[model samples]
Target: MKADFLKYQAQTTPHPLAMEVSYAKGSYIYDINCKKYLDFVAGVSACSLGHQHPKVVNAIKNQLDKYLHVMVYGEYAQKPAVELSKLLASHLPAPLDTTYLTNSGTEAIDGAIKLAKRVTGRSEIIAANKAYHGNTIGALSIMGFEERKQAFRPLMPDVRFIEFNHELDINQITTKTAGVVLETIQGGAGFIEPQDNYLKKVKERCDNVGALLILDEIQPGIGRTGKLFGFENYNCVPHVVVTGKGLGGGMPIGAFTASYEHMITLSDEPKLGHITTFGGHPVIAAAALATLKEITESNLIQETLEKEQLIRKHLKHPLITEIRGKGLMLAAMTPSADITNQIVLQGQEAGLILFWLLYEPKAVRITPPLTISNEEILEGCDILMSVLNKIQPTN
Candidate 1:
């Protein structure tokens, strides 16, 4: 299987982790050799309820018994999709009642950008530097990091960038801007959270300029940040909210929400401006609904803070320079990129899952499942500490 994977699969990186998984259940993944590895990254923060959560699994099974994709999104009123959208609306703030489902987070980001332009009748988009919204062409155009996106030149035009958490950069948002898209908690950029009311200030600027504010909560939303949405923590309500990642538990989904007045515009002027073949597939929607219900109804959301504290307490070491971020969305920074790489590579052998932030080489991602137990948190931290100690320099 490994040989076939290498031969047939098109990979993004020269070398992938390439773990051969036999099965996964609740904060642990089992290799085909039957070795159990504690999952700290939670499939890169996509599996909200860990692996194969009971509620999500049962929901998918129930939905499967009924049907799969009935029709393109927004055409059919599927029960799972309708209930999921309604639940999301109830949880989110006003003017964010209507939802446009998509196949993945990047699609949702693209849709949100489109909605902003359609609503504002502007072409320019202001995005924060180091923000990782998604990988599609529209998303790639606004990506702040030039090294990763330079090769794909001539992307969508008129996309500008501003330094995140920098108050002075708010001036970049003007009336000509269609929207200002930002990660509620900047993911790939070392789990950086909004500080000094940065998001609120940006929203205010967008309002002053009549531009829309789009918050990309793909990594920090879905109860991972001690709240259903990361913007809530910062007291910033965006004109549009884009979410994905853990929204589907272990399944795949993404959605953008806005007011009915703004969302309905996409329907008439274009008479189907944006269409998806399986945006709200019944099975995936069922899993997402179940995941959202479980997270909101259970103590998982609040436990994220407790678990984050436990991780910080256990992961303290000379090699760990600082822990950035809040709740389950965290990044442990090391003194050097080599040390960070060593910890992640050696961690797999140590039976613990660890990952790296997209653009921050010295930052180790630690976004585990919200349902991860305190004991499990300590156990993973211990493994990380052990790895760091072995790699630490002796003066």
Candidate 2:
């Protein structure tokens, strides 16, 4: 199976973790040998309610009994999709009421870029240094890191890069700019949060210049942070918000929301301006609706802060420099990239599941499921600490 996996499956890396999964439940994944590994990464911050959560699974099953994708997005008034959109709008601020669903976050990002261009009639899209939106061509173009994107040159043109949390960079946004896209909390940049009202300042500048502000909430949104959306914690509301990851509760989904007045332009002037056939599949929408309802109705959102404090209290060690980010979205920084690689690999053998951030080689990604128990947190940390103890800190 391992050989077949390597030969048949195209991989993101030369060496993959390649865990042959028997099954997964709650906060643990069982290997083919029935070895249980405590989960700390939560499928890279996607499975908010944990593996095969009862509500999400039940929603999918129930929706399956009814129907599947009956029509392309926006052509049908599907119950699951309609309910999900309405609930999302109710929680969002005014003018961010309409949503367009897509297959994944990258697709939603591309859609957001197009929406900005349509609305502003401008082509310049700006993003942050070390920020990662997604991997689609349009998304790849705005990516701030040049090394990863150099091979894929001649991407969407007029995309500019700026420094995240740098107040002086806000001035780059001008009338020629269509959108200023940024992560609510910069995920790939070691979970960096907006500082000193930086996001608010950016929004104000965008308002001044008539450029739209688009917040990428793929990892930090969906109750992973203490709030339903990370922007709520930052004291700013963006003109456009792109969400995915945890929103699906383990299913695949992405959505971008904006004002009805702004979104309507996409449908009429261009007729099928941005269309996705399976964007709002019934089964996926059902699962997402259940995930959103559970997060909003329960204490899970607030408990994220408590859980975050619990993790911080327990996971300290000499090799650790600092823990960056809030709520369940955290990046525990080791002294060096070599140490991070060692910790990540040894962690699995120590009976814990860990991962790494994209651009930050020194960050040990520790975003666990929001539903993880206190006992589970201790269990994972103990394993992680044991691994940390095995390696000597190199100065």
Candidate 3:
């Protein structure tokens, strides 16, 4: 299986962890050798309730028994999708009631950008520096890092970059701007949280300019950050909220939400403005519905902060310079990129799972499942500390 994976499967990077997975449950994954590796990076923050969560699994099974893909998105009222959207509306702020589901975070982000342009009739978009929305062309166009995108030029035009959490840059959002897109917590850029009401100020600026603010909650949504959404931590509501990652438990799903008035703009003038055949996939929607219900109904969301504190307390080591982020979404920065790489590889070998952020080379990602227990946290941290001690610093 490992040989076939390397030969047949497409590679993201030459150095894939290449761990042969037999099965996974809760905060642990078992390899073919039956080695249990404690998962700390929950599938890059996708597995909210960990692997094969009962609620999510049962929801999919229940939906499968009924039907699947009866029609395209929004044409017919599917129960799972309908209920999921309505549930989202109830949880979200006013004017963010309507939702447009997609296959992934990138597609949802593309829809949000299109909606912003269609509603406001503006082409100019402002995104944050080092901010990552998605990998799609429309999303890549708005991405802050130019080096990675330089090869893929002629992206969506009129996309400008601004510094994240910089209130002074709010003045750049003029009436000409259709939307200002930003991750509620910049994920690829080392999980940087908004500082001192920065998001609120940006919201005010967008309000003044009649520009829409699109908050990318892809990584921080779905109760990853103690709240149902990361934007809730900051006292600002965005014009459009893009969500995915853990929204579907372990299933793939994404959604962009707006109010009835704002969402309606995507219809009419250009009929079928935004359409996706598999956007609101019934099975995925069922999983998402169950995931949302689980997060909201259980004490999981509230307990995230306590779990975060536990990880932080146990993960402390002289090698770990600092910890950044809130709730379960955290990054442990080591002395150097070399040291970070060593720790990640060593931890994996030592029956622990660790991963890296998209952009921050020196930071080790620690976004575990929201369902991870206190014992699991301690266990993973022990492996990490052991790895840290094994690798001495050159400095």
Candidate 4:
């Protein structure tokens, strides 16, 4: 099967680890060889409750027995989707009552961008440098990294990028700007947090310019951060908040939420402005509902801080520069990309899983499942330390 993966499957990177998986439960992924590898990446922060979470799995199975896809989004009132949306509304602040669900984070991102353009009647978009929204054309258009996007030029015209956390650049957003899209915590940019009320200041600028703030909380949403959403930590409520990643627990789902007034605008003027065949999929909605319930009702949300502290206390090495990010979403920086690469590969060889951030060369991703236990954190950190100790830094 590994040979087949190399021979037949389309590869993303030139050299893929291509580990063959058997099944996963809790915070561990079992390879076909039955080796239980401690999963620190959590499917790149997508598995909220970890692999095969009982509640999430049961919700999916129960929903399968009831119904699946009934109709397109906003047309039918499926029980799972309706209940999920209502639950989300209850958790969100006013004006963020309504939600538009999608199959993936990028789809939700695309919808949010369109909604911003439609509601504001502006064409230009302002995004933060090193911001990563998604892979789709519309989502890709606002991506701040030029090298990755240069191959797909003429993406979306009038898309401008400003340095993130640069308070002086806030003025770049003007009335002509439809929306200023940003990652509440820049994921690909080394899990960089907004410094010293930067997000609040950005919100003020957007308000002054009549521009909407569209925050992409795909990575930091669903209690990955200590708060329910990363923006809650910043004390700024955006006009639109886009979420996915861990939203579905282990399933595929995404959603963009806003006030009833702001969200309802997409229904008319250009009637049926945004439509999708499988936006509010019932099974996926059930899984997301279960995921949300588990995160909110249990002590899991509060426990993230403790887990983060445990990992930080255990991860010690001379090669490590600094640890960045909050809760389970973190990145450990090394001296160079080559050293970072060796540590990740060697750690995996020693039975621990580590990954890299999208655009951060020297940062190793450490977004383990929120469900990971204290022992698992210590074990993973030990493996990382062992690998780091073996490497000799060049003078």
Best by lDDT: 2
Tens digits of per-residue lDDT for model 2 on 1-395? 88999999999899999999999999999999999998999999999999989999999999999999789899989999999999999999998999998889999999999999999999999999998989999999988889899998889999889999999999999999999999999999899989999999999999999999999999999998899999999999999999999999999999999999999989978799999999989999999999999999999999999999999999999978999999999999999998999999999988899999999999999999999999999988888889999987676
Q: What is the lDDT of candidate 1?
A: 0.92
- Model 4, range 1-395, lDDT digits (tens) per residue? 98999889898889998889999999999999999889999999999899999999999999999987878888988988989999999999877899999999999999999998998999999998999999899889888888888898778888999999998899899999999999999999999999989988988888898889999999999999998988999989999999998999988888999988988899999889988889889999999999999999998889999998988888877788999999999999999999889988988889999999889999999999999998889889988999998987764
Tens-place lDDT per residue, model 3, 103-128, is: 99999999999999998999999999
Total clashing pairs for each candidate: 0, 0, 1, 2
What overall lDDT, based on C-alpha atoms, would model 2 receive against the true structure?
A: 0.94
Number of backbone clashes in candidate 2 = 0
- Model 3, residue pairs in steric clash: 95-259
Global local distance difference test of model 3: 0.93
Candidates' TM-scores?
0.99, 0.99, 0.99, 0.98
After superposition, candidate 1 runs with Cα above 4 Å error: none
Residue 261's lDDT within candidate 3 is 95
Q: lDDT value for candidate 4? A: 0.91
Off by over 4 Å in 3: none
lDDT of each: 0.92, 0.94, 0.93, 0.91
What tens digits encode model 1's per-residue C-alpha lDDT throughout 290-333? 99999999999999998889888888899999999999999999
Candidate order by lDDT, decreasing, is: 2, 3, 1, 4
Model 2 earns a TM-score of: 0.99
